[model samples]
Target: MKLYHLPLSGHAHRAVLFLSLLGQKAELIEVDIPNGAHRTPEYLELNPFGQVPVLEDDGLVVNDSNAILVYLATKFGRKDWLPDDLKSVAKVQKWLSVAAGEIAYGPCAARLVTVFGADFRADEVIARAHRILKLIDQELEQHQFIIGDKPTIADVALYSYVVGAPEGNVDLMPYINVRHWLARIEALPGFVEFPKTAVGLRA
Candidate 1:
């Protein structure tokens, strides 16, 4: 398997973390997003959206962090990460949606603004990020993991940005449960630290 990624992208980090946790191996190809590598003709042919974290496996190309999570969990991970039960599956799907929807707009967008100096509607984005974090904190108060007792792709999908929220000037300290939850995710086997700065991309 080959993964095209940007080292500092939380979306890309999600895939890296999943592969690491599952003890799966893949060749990593760093994409220079700032240099428009993702937009090159060769790369655009792989993913029209020109996004990082494109996974190539056995001639199949998958993009989008959450989509990649689903594919990996279904194809490679244990049943606990992508359950076969109907209700359990729906629960997992719910969190994945939250990860893609609210998490994307809030923490991810804020990080882009801080790290890349991307123009964003600051107050709106920060407030939206906090709203999502508050809900997540409440959810964590009752559950050890997102869906069930064990960690799942849902946890992997949400972990990166939420853990990196402070870089965007969004404090997780206000959410006690979330702080503990982040610690729990960090304690998982094979977990790797995310680069603290955009310049730390090589790590």
Candidate 2:
């Protein structure tokens, strides 16, 4: 297995965390996103989308972070991480959507603005992101993980950007439950700390 990734990417971190937790080893090929290496012809052959994370398992190419999470969990992890029950599956999918949607636009995009100086209608998007965070805060008020008691792929999928919210200038202080939930995730075995952004992206 080969994982083509960028060091700073939260999406890439998801796969890294999952592989670590499962004690699975894949050749880590660091892609140079800053130099447009992902856009090169060589990388384009691997993934047309030119995304940071393109996992090549055997001969199969898997793109998309959430999809990778599902694949890894189903292929390598215990049933606990990727439950087979219909309701459990649906619950996990919901948070996967949250990770790709709300978390993507909020903390991820905000981090982009800080890192690349990319124009990100910050005023509008930040507010929308905050609303989503508040909803997550409320959800965490009663539950330890996103889906249930034990951490699942749902938590791994969402953990990166949501945990890195502080770097995106999104304050976690107001969301006490969310903070507690983050602590729980961090406390999990094989947990890894994300690198702090050096671009002064924090609020």
Candidate 3:
């Protein structure tokens, strides 16, 4: 298996973090997004969207980060990470959608603005980040993980951009429950960190 990724991408980091947590090994191929490597013809063949965190395994290509997490967990039979029951599965799918939709335009987009100079309205995205974060915090206030007590791919899906939210200047201090939840994931075995932004490093 090969994971084509960019170190600074939250989307990529989620996939990388999950692989480690699952004790799965894959070749790490760093896609040079800054130098147009992801936009090249060859990379386009792998992911038509030209996104980072594309996974290639045994002639199969998985294009999105959430998709990669689902694939890995299912393939490895890590039910602890990907539950098989009915209600849990539906809830997990719901959170995954949040990760892709709300989380993407929320924290992810905000971070992109500050970290990579992407042209998104900072105020808008930051507000969106806080809104979804408040809902997540409310849910996590009672449950150990997004879906329930055990950590699932839903947790992995939400972890990256949420952990990196502050880099976009969206303060996380107000969300104590969310902070605690993050600490729990970090304490898990084989956990990995999403790299701080260049600005954060210099600070």
Q: Can you write out model 2's per-residue Cα lDDT over 15-39, one digit (the tens) per residue? A: 8888887778899999988889999
Q: What's the C-alpha lDDT at position 138 in model 2?
A: 86
In terms of TM-score, which candidate is stronger, 2 or 3? 3
lDDT of each: 0.87, 0.84, 0.92
Q: lDDT of model 1 at residue 152?
A: 91
What does the lDDT read for residue 189 in candidate 3? 97
With candidate 3 superimposed using the best TM-score fit, by how many Å does residue 23's alpha carbon deviate from the native? 0.4
What stretches of model 3 exceed 4 Å from their correct place? 198-203
Model 3 C-alpha lDDT per residue in residues 1-203, reported as the tens digit of each score = 99999998999998999999998899999998888998899999999999989999999999999999999999998988888889888999999999999999999998988899999999999999999999999999888888888899999999999999988888889999999999999999999998886553234
Per-candidate clash tally: 0, 1, 0
Quality of model 3 by C-alpha lDDT: 0.92
Please, what is the TM-score per model? Answer: 0.95, 0.95, 0.97
Candidate 2 lDDT score at position 33: 84
